[model samples]
Target chain A: MQTEQITETQKENKKQSTWRTAVSALLIFIAVPATIYLGWKFADRQHYIVSLLIILYSMVPFFLMYEKRKPQARELVVIAVMCAIAVVSRAAFIWAPHFKPMTAIVMITGIAFGATAGFLTGAVSGFVSNFIFGQGVWTPWQMFAAGIAGFLAGILMHKGILKKKRLHLCIFGGLTVMLIVGPLLDTSALFTMASGISWESARLIYLSGLPVNAIHATATVLTLFFFSKPMLEKLDRIKLKYGMMGD
Target chain B: MDDAFSGYHPAVNFIFFIGAIVFGMFFTHSAFLCASVFTSMLYYLLLMGRKGIKLLCTMLMLFFALSFINPLLNTQGDTVLFTYIGERPFTLEALMYGFVTGGMFVSVLLWFACYNCIMTSDKFIYLFGWCIPTISLLLSMVLRMVPNFKVKIMTIAGARKCVGKAPVNGDKKEKLQNSMDMLSVLTSWALEGAVVTADSMRSRGYGSGKQSNFSIYRPSVRDMAAGIIMLFCIVLTIICAALGGMEVAYFPVFILPEANIITILGVIGYTAFLLLPSIIHIWEEATWNILRSRI
Candidate 1:
């Protein structure tokens, strides 16, 4: 009789789960059409809003999972701030033309903090800084490209490529990223902005990006190799002082 | 970042999901100019209400600085600002165009920031997962992969340091060697992890002939009603856009025949309609909580 009761409970749970799945399916069906329709409507208006919406939308699934995987507020704030700083610093190089230095800072941030932080920093910086010059559909890709640079660096650190003293290797990797991934990102942006097939335009954009990319990589390598461990240690001390880092 | 992935209002997520697609379709045209200006101001107001407006201000300042400086450096415009040492052109037109473009760019970014602040990532998955399980799963895996990859990097770096060859600040050759080593380790681990995941998923019949099922949070009747209204708004907006009722152009002189009085009203009406779901849901929840408190 007890075994039968347990089986009955199981059946009830299955029924409930099935109901949940059906509702979820219906919501998805509604969402896709709405997205496409909205896209068609907003097309040729404020391109930035679209980008803003996507970045914001990307946050939704994570938010839904928050209760099961709670994130610390302090961590989010730090990541946001770090990203803001990284992007702004890169923008500053537009005047001074320093590529290596900025990249190093980005790399260090990623290596020490982790990929999400790197992504946040890269994305936030790109988006925020771009707003000053002009905004369009290209912003997300710019954010993705720059942020991914830091993200990849962080991943390398995870795999043991970046270390406390491996300055040269980190620098080499940073340069390789510029030559390879950097141009491709710029190309994609140009392609999206207009169907301009001009090699000249592509070359111009790529050339313009070179200095900034170099600065970013060089700065990232230097900071990652030298200051990261110490700075991270200092951050830990600050956390301890403020009672921010949770056990 | 405890809240890095939490507290997304469903209403906000829905707004953004539709909003992004709109941006994707219309970014190249001149109407984007007007939309950029209008939305920038709206975004500023939205941020101000949230008491998080300083971020927008900071970003705007940067935009101004970049627009002005970019022209000076590039020296490629027609209406020259001043002759430099090489007689390089710095057109007033380019600077002005850049400024408008820059403003548009920043406004969009601020919009995204606002979105990020309000909407968490999980809602994105829940909204998309039911219809597109394969893509949703891939996204989920990517998110999880980030932290996992970080852990592995730290572990390997520590292990290498112990074995001595800790070339953090080495010559170019040493740096090259270390990078390659790191890549090799990362690639192997990633491949292994992918294989394991595939095997595990197959065991559970993830991609078998049988249709898969997912358990998710249930939407109330109110949620369904809200969803319907949003869909209606989306359709209306598309019609408005397609009919050219929303188009705006500038630089042959900024004009928007699409922004006729009737079309403007329609746009406003549809937007309100889209927002009805959120307003209703919030009101219902408040009433329920209040009654529960009284009891």
Candidate 2:
């Protein structure tokens, strides 16, 4: 009688588990295809859905890794700030003698903050700016590239690879980033915008745009050099006022 | 490490994240047409399935609305769809074109939405963090800062309103002044923030060049496999995209209708690969949980 009861209980548990698995799997399959198809159809008119999805997707890895740290008020504030700066910076790019180098600014901000903060700044800046300037597939690339740049700065700063005072170090690092990785982003944008242009031609176009690229690098370094000291001083004052960080 | 973020490896996130963006960059020209077809198929496949015929009908309704409204407003096409206000002749070709273009436009936006869902900001940072530190750091800061700035603006704006000197709406000058005021406040705050950060860094021996350590998240075998698949898909997509497999230029001519096999194949291949990982992960997780529960 005891053996029978145990078997019965085990069977019930297995049945329930199977049911749950099937339901979850079905839901995922349904959700994935539905999103892609719906997203594909309304992609032009209602691109917000995609952006919404991306924002939601970001929470996935976060959720998977940590059960306790929920998205919060303070964190939301940071996301908003990064977005605004990104927009402003992109707009500023249009006005710069060439294009105001923004990677440095984003990098600096990320270093000061943390990883998520840095990534958001770059991503948001690219996103907001693109929305204002143009609405194309290239916008996502910009967001990713710019965001990556900022995120890199944060990680390196954390690791002591990048320093505040070493303007040359920052500039060289920023330039190297642009020269190697920048091309891929440039090519991506070009391919999307003007697909007819051969990859070779696209490379030439990007190469020709070197002046603008240089300006971007120079502007970034100069801005950092001029602002870092004052900014640090002010940050110190804020820390004192808020007592957020101990001396 | 201190519990600010989960232990998800930034490196894997970055790789996939960039891959996603690169994927997105493949869809620039056919914006309207491609988006339209993709969205229709998406809605039908995801929602209606074999009964997608009903969804297609709904899609037609949407297409009619967009195309009809578009030419009436845009009036750029050479072929007239109809006569709107007497002198304004809307050509049939134009209306149809508009309809297709509108569909494309909508579809492209939807595709981006899906792309965003798959590739996120976290992934972007993780991939590129090592190569470009300062920029990456600043980006993160900006992400955090944008929200901060918004709060400050709202608070200041609210306080001003309460004082009966509301600075919400006005002419350019007033708006400029309001912005200037905001900038002043922001600058003051930023300066203060900078000082604190520098002090913190200095104390932490940031520039000490002691080969500071970072909690690197090495890619697991699964992650590597996933990365390889993503890279391969992107490469194939680019090649196809470059060969005009996806291009459908309007005005002079409208080539490659949805019925075209090559175009259909490209669309299918791209969509399938794009959504592959998420599908697999979701499936695997469900299975794992079920087995665990059973145990």
Candidate 3:
């Protein structure tokens, strides 16, 4: 009887997983492209609104997946602790301009936890920190960028492409910031502040942002190089002790 | 000095700000821009008083810098004001476009500043909790954890100082190592504490049933009135924009809408929406003074 009940529960879990997969696939493959097409077709002049909507919509699938899992209170607390650490570390490095451990910390959370948790940690930190640093038009874009960084970190680690080694983690962290987060922020500035969107203006905006991106990338790389080992070990110990977030 | 507008329902506050910010972003007409910037400045001053002056000045500098940068990058207009390096023609139309864009940017920023002052964290959570409960709970948890971690870090640092491991006037690498050690220690301590917090929450029956939220805000009759007025103004302005009453073009040549009744009314509606908060505050102050005089 117990064996039969276990099989039935496993089948139910499989069904739910398939359903989730279908929904996520549909959202990514159809809904995202539809939003982009409609946005560009109708709101040509209002790129800011269109881009903002795209970012918001892209985040929905992750949130839905996280909610469906019914995470335990311990898992929620762990994610919250990671976010707080990211925010506090940002504050702690205020004396050094463009030198923040936020991205590295988010990436470490991703490596230790999973993608959804990583994204939540990054997104929440991006948001709550702005309450202290002052909210602005760039808040949504910043949130999206930071969340994507953590998401990518989680993905790479899961795929075994990104190891726990210091060099490997540092390279991934640096490249992600330079290629992803930095450009996303510059794109926000381009759409919002620029009088007109042109190839020349876009080039100027990206070019102007390059130096800042380099500094940010360097910060991420340095943070990972110096701290990833100890942080990962600490996180592993907690995971073992609590048996929480065991993906 | 407390603003009367902030005392309204969060829904009212949220709607008013969304209307102000969206219209401020979309409209490029001189009248709309002027109304937005002027009213936002007034409200920001009312909210922040003397402390706002420094940020206001910084925004002013940013506005000028942005305005100047636009003409340099965009050489689109026909009316050449001057020729610069590489024969880049600085045009009158582009300059005007820059000013409008800069004005829109600054006004939106000012409105956000006022928003920060009015929309406290609890108000934000109250508004969003129902829509996204998990994320909202996470936000609340993170907010709660940030101050806790800060206190813990201080305690740890103090303890480390007692043990002679505190960071001193050292080289860059030494300082970096010291900070990293502090962070690692903080992380371990926080994670350990977090497991206990989670267990405590579970013991308190979290996730055992549907959750109920408690909020102090309730929409009153005045909030309803304010909401109705704001909705009417927003609808009016949006209709005006859709009808091209607020249209302006500044590409090859500058174009402005002919001043008609609809355009005038649109501008008035926009101004009224933006000025609602300041008006409420001033009116409340006047009433209080009258009552105090009678007393």
Winning candidate number (lDDT): 3
For model 3, residues A1-247, the per-residue Cα lDDT tens digits are 8888768766765676677677778877887788677555433246766666677777777776786676899999889999999999854454467688998999999999978888988888999998887787888888889999999999899999989898899889988999999999999999888888899889999999999999999989988998899999988888888888876
Error of 2 at B200 (Å): 2.3
TM-score of chain B of each: 0.63, 0.59, 0.96
Residue A245, candidate 1: C-alpha displacement in angstroms = 44
Q: Candidate 3: which pairs clash?
A: none
| TM-score, A chain, model 3 | 0.85
Better-scoring candidate (TM-score), 1 or 3? 3
Q: How much of the real interface does each model capture, measured as fnat?
A: 0.06, 0.09, 0.66
Q: Assess the local accuracy of residue B4 in candidate 3 as a C-alpha lDDT between 0 and 100.
A: 94
Docking quality (DockQ) for each candidate: 0.06, 0.06, 0.54
Q: Ten residues in a row with the worst lDDT in model 1 chain B?
A: B1-10
Q: Write one digit per residue (lDDT tens) for candidate 2, span B106-190.
A: 4544444433433345455555454333344445565556556566656766776665434444664454344434444555654
The full ranking of all candidates by lDDT, starting with the best, is: 3, 1, 2
The lDDT of each candidate is 0.51, 0.51, 0.85
Candidate 1 stretches greater than 4 Å from native: A1-183, A188-204, A212-247, B1-15, B20-54, B65-100, B115-121, B130-132, B167-172, B186-198, B209-214, B247-249, B255-259, B270-295
State the lDDT at B31 in candidate 3: 93
**Residue B200 accuracy (lDDT) in model 2:** 70
Candidates in descending TM-score order: 3, 1, 2
| Candidate maximizing TM-score | 3
